[model samples]
Structure formats: C-alpha cells, structure tokens
Target: MCVKCDNCGAEIGLDGVCKFCGTVLPPREPVAPPPVAPGWGTPPPRPVFSIPQPRVPVQQPVQAASPKSRWVAILLWLLLGYLGAHQFYAGKVGMGILYLFTFGLCGIGWVIDGVSLFAGSFRDRYGLPIRV
Candidate 1:
C-alpha cells in the first residue's frame, strides 16, 4: 500500500524515506480503528457542483498626466522639501515660498502632501499628475 508524506502529504513509498517531501519517517504510529457503529458502511463523499467563473476586469482612467518622475519629487523632499524645494521644482513658486517661510506648513502640510503624492492624488502646479 502507498502512504502519504507525514508533513507535505505527497505520495511516498510504503517503506523508508520520502524524496518528494524530504521527510524522514522516524517510526510509524499504531493505526486507529474507525468510530462507526458496526453496521453502517462509509458515508458517500461530498458533492462539488459550482463551476469556475472568470474574474472581473479592472477599470483604469483613460487620461494620464505628464509631469516629473515621482523620484525627483521625493528626492527634493528628502533633501530640501521642508523648505519647499520640491514645491519649487514642481512649479509652485508661491507654495514653495510659503513652505520655505512656514517650515513645510509646520510639518503637517508636508505629511499630508507626502501621503497624497505617493498615493497618486497629488498634482503639479500645472494640474499634471506626479507620476508615482
């Protein structure tokens, strides 16, 4: 009789070790008897009925924005974003100046802007998407 691997359950030889699952059978345990009440035969297997269906197609926006790469923005942010260097690079001179004076809106504005920019919700001063 063939036996399944004790770990991965792949079919293995009746004796020795299993190469497919790489499990060494230390020792076999004593087989237990079934708990049926003597007269009943084994119950029928459960039925599988549902047919597989195709997955739904994902929808994407048709129009795309042309702006600078997300890395440049993130780089400027890392280097001088607190002083609005990233905003200046993105052509938002006013906000850049404001950020320079206000310390990136006292850190609150940049935190929100960082999340929005990374999440694809942020746009440039010219209303172009930041290609994240």
Candidate 2:
C-alpha cells in the first residue's frame, strides 16, 4: 500500500512522509488486521550502513633539494672565484681559467655565486633542485 499527499497528490511511504519534498502526510485511518498462517516466521531486520566515511583530503610527499653543485660553486668562489675558481667548481673549466688569467676581475664571479645561493637557483651536478 502507498501513502499520498493531499496537497500535491504525490505518493508517500508508510511513514506518512513524502520523499520528494519532505512534506508530512495526513494520518491514516485504522484498519482491520488480516489473518496469518501458523508456520510463518518474522523476517530479519535490514542491515545498517553506519560508515567508512571519507574525511580529510590526502597530500603529496615533498621532495628534498640537492647541495653538491651549490657547495662546489661557493667553495670555488672562496678559493679561486676571485679569479673564477667557483666557475671551475661549477664545471666550467674554460671560464675558471679565463677568470684565473684575469685575476678574478674584482671578484665578480664570487659575488654572483653569493647571490645565486640566496636566490635558491643554484643546482648540483646531478641536476637536482637546490634547497636554500
């Protein structure tokens, strides 16, 4: 048997509640009970789904920075970058030699290395990202 809404003529459930608009239905009239067979047994209750509800969003792992190249650059600048020592440390042998011949040109290469260190743009020989 189905319940219905008088205002909208929509079908409701036994709860006297309409699923569509959640409107309450009028009370049902009492009816006579039907006869039952002697051997019939009651059915089990329906199962409930309490949860396994999703909560927080997942995040990705953070990657670490490499320091090999940056340190070499700094070291070269300190030891010989006044004459492009650090350029050689960064694997640029030609520039290092040029700076060496030029007496480090007022230490310009060393200064650039200092700036690169602060800017977090210097990388290692393996091409990994450098951490500041």
What's the TM for model 2? 0.38
Top candidate when judged by TM-score against the true structure: 1
lDDT of 2 by residue, 1-132 (tens): 666677777888778888777898668688977856666666657899897988988888876766455665666666666777566655566766877787765566557667876676765545555563
Poorest 10 consecutive residues of model 2 by lDDT?
123-132
Tell me, by lDDT, which candidate is best: 1
lDDT of 1 by residue, 1-132 (tens): 677887888877766578787787877787898678865987767998998899999899776774577888888887888899888888899999999999999998778778877787667888888885
Error of 1 at 111 (Å): 0.7
| Regions more than 4 Å wrong, model 1 | 1-61
lDDT of 1: 0.82
